[model samples]
Target: MYKVDKDLLAIQEARIHIEGAKEAAIELRNFTQEELDVVVNKMAIAIKPHLEELAKQAVEETHYGLCQDKLLKNRFACEYLPQQLANQRYVGVIKENYEQKTVEIGVPIGVIVAMIPATSPVSTTIHNAFIAIKSGNPIIFSPHPRAQKTIQRTVKLLKEAAIVAGLPEDGINYMQLVSSTSTNELMNHEETALTLVTGIPKLLPKLKAANKPFIYGGSGNGPVFIERTCNIQQAIHDIIESRTFDNGIVSAAEQSIVLDGPIVEQAKSELTRQGAHFLSEEEAMKLVNVLMKKNGDLNPESVGCSACELAKKAGIQVLPTTKIFIYEQAYVSENNPFAQELFSPILALFVEPNWQEACEKCIELLMEGAKSHTLVIHSNDEHVIREFSIKKPVARVLVNTPSTLGGMGATTNLFPSMTLGSTSLGIVQASDNISPEHLVRIRKVGYGVRTLNDCFNESGNQSLHSKDTQESIEVILRKIINEMKE
Candidate 1:
C-alpha cells in the first residue's frame, strides 16, 4: 500500500478544519454579544491557571524571550484583553446612528486563517482565539513548526473552555499536521474569509498571493527620538525599559535612538547609568556578524537574546548586568545592520544637530525597516510633540512612553492586540490594532436619510461665497499669472 504524501495529508487536514470552522461560524452568528462575551470570559478564566505553564513551555520550546515576560504577556492577553472587550459590542446590532438615520449590524467574516509566530506563540494564540470568538468568527491557527507543541496545548485548553461556555467545538482549531503547504492551503481555502497574520517578512509574499483579504502585522524597527525639550531621565528610562522588554522581541520596541545634540551627553549618561553597554567598533562588527545573515535576514539564534547573552555569543565580555547593547552610528541605510530591527536587546544611537535633523534621521531609520508601524517621541514641548506626531510615517507615535507597552495598549488607550496592522503605507490592509471589530463586517441600515434630488438641490442651494471667495480667486489667479510672466 502506498502512503499519502505528508504535504497532501496536511492539506486535507486543513480543508477538514476549514469546513468545520465554516459551519461553526454560521452557528456563532446566531449568538448574542452577551453570549459571546460569556464564552470569552470563560476562556480567559480557564487559560489563567495555565498561563505560567504555557509561558514556560513556550520558552523551552522556542528558546526565545524570557518566561517571566511571556507570563506577563499571557496574562495581558487572557486578563487585560478580556477586560477591554467587556464593554465593547461585537455582534448583532452594535451601533445605531439616530442622527444619520442608520443602524449598523455586525456580521462575522466567516472562518479566519491565523498564522502564529514562534516568538509569541501562546499569547498570540490566546489573543487571536478570544477576538475571533468574541466577533462570532471561527479561527483555525497555523502554528509555527518550532512552537507547535506549546501552541497546540494552549489551543486545546482554550477550545475546552470555549466549549464548556457554549461555544461550538470546532469554533477554535489548529493544524495538527503542521507544514508550509498546510498553511498555504488554509490561507487559500475557499471557506476562509480573512487571514490574520503576524510574523516575519519572508511569509508576506505568500500571504499576498493567497488572493484573499488579509490583515498583516509586518516588521517594526521603530525609532525613539529624544528632542532637546524632553525630560532626559524619563526619556532614557522609557527607551531602556521598552527596548529591553522581552529581550526586545516586540516589533514596536525601539531599534534606534536619535538624540538631539543639546541633550546627547545627558541622555548618554542616563543610558549608561541604566546599564547600557556601548559597543566598540570591533565588538559592534562582531555582533553584526552574529545577528545578521549574508542575505540580510535576522539570525533566528540571535533573536530575543539578552544583551549579556548576545555579547557572550559574539565573543565579547560584558557586565552581566547589561540591560542593553548600543552601537554609535552617524547614518542610516538598508545595508546598515545596526539600523534594522535586531529583535534583541541591541540599539543603534545617532546624535543629530537639532530636532528637525533628528526627525529626518528617525524617518530615514523607519524607511530602512519600520515603515508605517510605530515611533516614539520624548518631548514635553507641545509644539515639538505635535510636529513629530504629524510628520512621522509611523501609524502610532508614542509620546513619552515605552513603545512596546504603549503600542500594545498596556500603557495607552490603544486597542490591546497581538496582531498590529501596518495599514496601506506598509502595504497592509488595516492600520489599527487587530480587534474583534476587524474580524467582522459592518452592515449599514439606512432609512432614506435624503433623496437623490434632495442632495442635488441642497448642494445647488448652497452659496459658494465665504469670506471674499471672488477676491481670493482673483488674488490666486493674479499670483499665478505674475509667476508665469516672471
Candidate 2:
C-alpha cells in the first residue's frame, strides 16, 4: 500500500489555487508588446538573483553536480531565455493594419502542469514557471524526487520574486516530493489545461492518455561522427567535452563516436591526451555487456557513472583520478550492449577503416534509439555536414562545436533547452530545441468591409470577370453549358 505525502497534498492545494488563476489569466486577452516586454524583462530581472541563490541551494542540498555548472544553467534559464522571448506578445490584440482594420487576438491556455527533471532541476523550474506566467498561464511544477529540496527552495524564491515583480500570488506552485503516482495524478488532473513534460519515453503515453494537450520532449541518443576529412584534434576535443560535461547526463550528450580512416588513430591519440584512458579489449567488452541488460533497457545504476565508479563496478581498483574511460570495440553485435546510452563519462568508440563504415555505424546507432533523440557530426567540410544533416533523421545535427553545449543551445544561437525533440517516429516535434512559442496558439482576424456592398467591392470584385479574366471564365462556362446540353 502507498501513503500520500504532505508534499503531495500541498501540490493538490496549489492546483486548486491555479484553478482561479487560470480564469484570471484567460481574462487578460490582449497585451501590448511593451507590456509583454516589461513582464518578461521584469520576470527575468527578478529571478536572476533568485536563480543564483537557488542554484547554490540545489548543489548544497542535492550534493550532485558542480556549483559552477549549475550557475551556468541558471544563467541560461534566466538570461538567455528571456532575451529570446522579449518583445513577443501573447496578449489580447495585434493590429495587422489599421487601414485594413485587421486585428489578431491572443488567448491564454489557462493553467499548465510542468513536470521537470532532476538533472536540470532549478534552471527548468525557473524557465517553465516564468514562461507560463508570461503567457498568462498559472503553473504547477512537479520536480524529480531526487531534487525536490532544490525545487521547493527555487519555487519559494520564484514566488517571492513574482510577488515583488507585482505578479499574482501563488502564480507559481510546486511539489516538494515527487513520485510516479503523484506525477500521474498531476497529468491526469481534469483541471490541467496543458502539460509540458520533459523526460523519459515511458511517461509520454500517460500524458497522452490524460487526453489533455501536451508538449512532451523525447530522449536523445546523440551520436558524434568524425569524418576522415575533418580536423582530428578539434573533433576529439569537442567529442570529449560533449561526452563528459555534467557527467554525460544531458540528453544532448554524445553517446557514441564513429571515427573513420587514418584519423581514427589520430583521434584516439588526441582523446588519450585529453585524459581519456583506453580500456583493454577484454575490460571494454565486459563493461559493455554488463551495462546493457538483457531486456534492452538502460541500467540506471551504470548510467551517468564516473570512470572510477564504472571501474569499481567491474571490480577493478582503478585510480580515482581518472577523468574519462574509453571503451574500444572492433564490431557492434547483439551480444554487445554498447548500442545503449551510458550516461556516464564512458565513451564508446567505433573505429572504421573508411568513412562509409563510420557513417553506416552512425545511422545504425541512431536506429537503436531512433525517435527519441539527436545525432552529431564534427566536420569542417560543408558538403559532409550538409549530407549528414540532410540524411540523418535525428532532430538536431550538431557540427564543429561540442554537442553538449551546441546541441543544448548554450554556446550556439539555437534556443537553449534541456529538451530535444525527435520527429522520426512522432516521439516529439522535429524541433532541435523547444521554447515558450511552442506552447501558444494565435487567432488571426480578417477585416476590410463593414457593409454588404463594401464586402463585394473589397472581396467579390477582386475575382470578377474583367476583360482579362473573360477568356478563362468563358472556357469554364462553355464546359458547364456543354455538359448540361449532353
Candidate 3:
C-alpha cells in the first residue's frame, strides 16, 4: 500500500466526518423541540458529574487557566447553559405576530464546523455542542493541537450521552486527525453551512477563504474605568477579582485600568491592599519584552500565568501573595504592551483628569486591539454609567461588576456563552454573547397588509399632479427667477 501523507489523511478524515454530519443534520431537522431538549438535557446531566475531572484534564493538557475556574466554566456550560436554553424556542413557529398576520419560523443552519481554542477547550466544547444540538444542527469540532486530547475526551463523553439519548452517533464529532488541512477541509465542505470559530486571529483569513458564513469569537483588550463617583474599594476589588480569575485567560477580563485623578491615590491604595503590585518603569519594560512575541502577538508562554510567575519570568522580585501586577502608564499605543490584551494577570493603569478624558483613554486602548469586545465601568452615579455605556465602542459595557463574569453572563443578565461574539468594531457576525438562537435562521412569513396603491396614497404622491401642486411648483420657480433677475 502506498503511504499517504498526513495532510491528505487529515483531509480525507474531514471529508468523511462532514459527510456523516450532513446526514445527521438532516435527521436532526426532523426532531421536535421537546425531543431535542431531552437529548441536550441528558448530555448536560452526563457531563455534570465529570466537571472537575475534565477541568483537571484540560489544565494538565493545555497548561492554561486554573482547574478551579475551569470547573466553574464547565458548570456554567453544562448546568446554566441548559437552563438558559430550556424554554427558548429554536424550531418551527418560534415567533408569531398575530396583529401583523405574520409568523417567524426557525430553521437549523446545517452542519457547523466549530473550531475549539486551547484556553477554554473543554468548556467551549460543551457549550458548542449544546447550542448546536439545541438548534437542531450537527456539529464537527476541530480541536486545538495543544488541547486536542482534552477536547476529544469531552466530545466523546458528550457523543456517548447524546447517543444514549437517541441522537445519531455522528451528531457530535471531533477531528481525530487534527491539522490545518483538516480544518480547511471541514470549513470548505459543501455540506458545511456555517463555521463557528473561537480561536486565534491567524485562522481568520483561512475561514474567510472557505466562502462560508462564520461567527468569530475574537480577543478583547477590555478596559475598566473607575469614575470618581464610584466606590473605590468595591471597584478595585472587582478589577482584582476579574483580572486574577483563571489567570486572566478570559478575553473579557480587564487589561487596563483608567482611574479618575481625584480617586487615583485611593484606587492605588485599595489595589495595593488587595495584593496588587505596581511595577516600576524598568520592571514594566521587562514584562513587555516577555509578554509579546517579536511579531506583536501574545506569547503563549506568558499567557494565563499568575502575576508572581510573570514577575519571576521578567526578573522582577515580588511577594508570593501578589495576585496582580500593575503597570502605571502615561499613554495608550501599540508600542505599549500594557495597553494591549496581555491574556495574563497584568493590567495597565492610567490616570485621567475627568470622566471624559478617561472615556477617551478607554477608547484609545480598545482601538489599539480589543475594540467591540467588552468594557467595564464602576460608577455609582447613573449619569456617569449612562455616559460610558453610550460613548464606549465595546459591545458589552459592564457596570459595577467584574468584566469577566459580567461579560460571560455569570454576574450580569447577558447571555451565558463560552464563545463571545465581537460584533461592534471586531470581525464577528453578532455582537451579543452567542446562544442557540444564533445557530438558526428566522424565516419570516408575511401576509400583505397593504396594496401598492395604498403605499402611494399613504405617501401623498397621488395628489402631486393636482392643480394646487402644479401652481405651487410654478410659483416657486417664478419666485426663483425673480430673485435671480434682481
Model 2, range 24-47, lDDT digits (tens) per residue? Answer: 465444444455456557767767
**Better candidate number, 2 or 3, judged by lDDT:** 3
- Candidate 1, residues 1-486, lDDT tens digits: the string is 997799999999999999999889889878999999999999998999999999999999999999999999999998999999998997799999899889999998899988899988998999999999999999998899889999999999999999999998899998999988898899888889988888656778887787778888757878898888888888888999999888899887888899899878888999999999999999998988889888877789998899989988899988878999989998887778887777899899999999888889888877774456888999988998888888887778889999999988999999998888784433356877889988888898999876543443455443335445446557878998999999
Residue-pair clash count for candidate 2: 8
Candidate 2 clashing pairs?
29-92, 30-91, 30-92, 31-91, 31-92, 219-372, 220-373, 304-344
Regions of model 1 farther than 4 Å from truth:
1-4, 424-427, 449-486
Clashing pairs in 3: none
- Predicted structure 1, TM vs. truth: 0.92
Lowest summed lDDT across 10 adjacent residues in model 2 is found at 453-462
Backbone clash pairs in model 3 (N, Cα, C under 3 Å; residues 3+ apart or in different chains), count: 0
Cα RMSD (Å) per model?
A: 5.1, 5.5, 4.9
Ranking by lDDT: 3, 1, 2
